[model samples]
Target: MTDPVLPDLWLDWCAVTGTPVDRRDEATLGRFVLQAAPSRKLLNTLRLAPLATAPAWPPALRGDATALSQLVHGGTSRINDPDVHWITRLRLRRLVFAAVLLAPANQGGLGLSRIQARGLTPGRLQSLRPVIGRTADEASCPACAVWSWLDVIGTNNDWSQDALRALGHHRDPAGGEVHRHERDDPSHGWLDWPDHPNLLPAIDQWGYLDRYGSLHPSSLSSLVHAIETLADARIAPARPASVEPVSAPPRITAEEEAAILARADELNARVARILKEYS
Candidate 1:
């Protein structure tokens, strides 16, 4: 099914007011905007011409009410996207490695004592450069370079289909390019890059980070925003009084409880020894 056209009223509200409409106002405003001339003009600009072409609402759509409510209220989490999780994991790994390298030899030795005492071996250090997507040879644009690193860390060592769709592309049935004025000259409009036919899926992957890196405040926030947008657009309209739900607690089975209890006992024993001197 074709994606739902982003409502012009919503877009205008976001642009002019710099805030999402409160739930109380959204439905009423949405209906009114559907019939307004300005809204029609905005829809035309977005090329959503045949308003009647929207797909019949899917039966499974109602099953996603919980997700839609989360999006409208802005209270979802990010672990849902594997790509974002992978990016965060890699970043954490890098941070851990840096910390180990900086730690003093007497404290929790990281096997880096020899390296700290006598400097890093050229070959060993060289191996790390490629892992971080850096070269000793040249300078690159910082933004592009970071995205290149993300490409290596993200899905299948390539771009993700979801990321591509977020940037306005379809896989099976193709879609048109969005063109915009590059300069104010009335004749100098530029189409978005990574054009189709020659488009590489890896290049398409960069679009996700580009569009969402800022929007995703934390990994959890990214998940929440993604779920909300998808749920709202693809599922049902949110209710006027619905507020975003709080995060549900993690589920723990009996075996997990035993593990926690064992860990607590071990910590208690250590604390008891430390407190004996005071007694």
Candidate 2:
């Protein structure tokens, strides 16, 4: 999954999938990748780039377990339980945001949000299950805990009333409940985001969910960096050094070349036969 291996991985994927390497169609290629069925290997290749960088996949595919773990660490940790954690304010918001954003309804997420979310879910919480790395509160059921926290946050944010109410509560019939740390403070306004369904660009632009949203790249980088730094802490950064230059695509082995040639010849022959039948 390192940078140096990406070229090989891409070449192998294309060969296995019978796709050609076409740099001119990177946008198309990127979309092709997103629409394809999920593969762990495919997932790793996409992570070679920063989530906010050019050629980025949509946020649905990007919220892998590692990213989810980092986003919801406090909730997963017994020692860093939201009740005692110093950064609980920010951590809890990020957890709720990630839950709503990443949990794909069509997937096993039970329609946690109206968005086309993917990745984290109650069943999948087993992946982020806390180890005894810390000692404060006993590790609880992450799935139930997540819903409880969502109910608390949504209630605090008043998501049950007015505009946000139309979107529905984060906790519904499908969601289970657990005891959550009590919070009497005012809402921090994490969802004060733009109306865009895909908040990835908005997050990339405004640098975090806030009242102000702007597209001017320079003004947003610092803010984006700060939030992304926290969220992407566990994510392996892209390695620019190992990336092959644009002109030099990965070299296929002689065996691979022959296989591709043979496949090409087979297709050509099939076409000729069909043409002859028409003729």
Candidate 3:
């Protein structure tokens, strides 16, 4: 089914991912970009979705027309040997948060209100400096700083693992993954300061954090773009999601799938040029 009416609050998945629409299946609804994921937690008041949030995964990956829900999960969702530089890490971390907002199912919210409640730049870093590590008593650590921001949005940073993986960064040198190992050492949860979990101590493992102070990336700007988009959705409420059904039934046979893709390629055949436009 297509969302005939644009959702009151939806994110442009293709725009954020810089990816263009290639599939034109009956299952889709939005005009150019599709609504892929659902986000109702923390920021439930706002309607936010990624550009590709509603479309199916690239058909190349689902030749058999496998279920997308089964595909999106069960994979590690993490990239291997990622850089540990603070700037790279921070951008990746922010994207991880954004990824959760784009999750396809059983999604949760970040409880993110402070940025909207308070201006994005005001008192944020200072309010954050106090408890950015494993606990309030520890020294300021960038990794923990991420957690503190999450703590503002949700219960703890543990919620970030799925987000991190979905966003494609599993090699967290700062080691936010420590929460996964907590069952083995219950006291790991009790540690109140200084030490957060990591494959190696972030101090010794990541040299970039100490080398750089406040350098930012285009990602931060892109994030601001997303925030502005969501903030506007809250104020204006956009259009209601269309519930009308597509002419095609829920299931399509293999021959039917082939015909659909062929029609799509014939209709939107620019390929490289189109990807460049969207990319």
Indicate which candidate wins on lDDT. Answer: 2
TM-score of each: 0.20, 0.25, 0.23
Candidate 2 per-residue C-alpha lDDT over 1-279 given as tens digits, one digit per residue, 9 for 90 to 100: 211222334433443444432331556457556655446665556555332311112254354533333433423332232242222333333333444333322211212212212222322332222210111222333343344444333332433334333222222222223223222322336642222222212221111222123223332233223224344332322112446689986677767766765654454344223222221
Among the numbered candidates, top TM-score falls to 2
Runs with alpha carbons beyond 4 Å of true place in candidate 1: 7-9, 18-279
Report backbone clashes per prediction: 5, 2, 17
Model 1 C-alpha lDDT per residue in residues 214-242, reported as the tens digit of each score? 11113222222222233333223222223
**Sort by TM-score, top down from the best:** 2, 3, 1
TM-score of model number 2 = 0.25
TM-score of 1: 0.20
For candidate 3, the per-residue lDDT at 174 reads 30
Please give the lDDT score at residue 88 for candidate 3: 38
- Tens digits of lDDT, candidate 3, 55-149: 31222322322222222111111112233333233333343333222222212211122222112221332232222122221111232324422
Instruction: Return the lDDT, model 3, position 107.
Output: 20
Model 3 spans with C-alpha error above 4 angstroms: 1-79, 82-87, 98-106, 111-221, 224-279
lDDT of 3: 0.28
Each prediction's RMSD over C-alphas, in Å, is 24.4, 23.6, 19.4
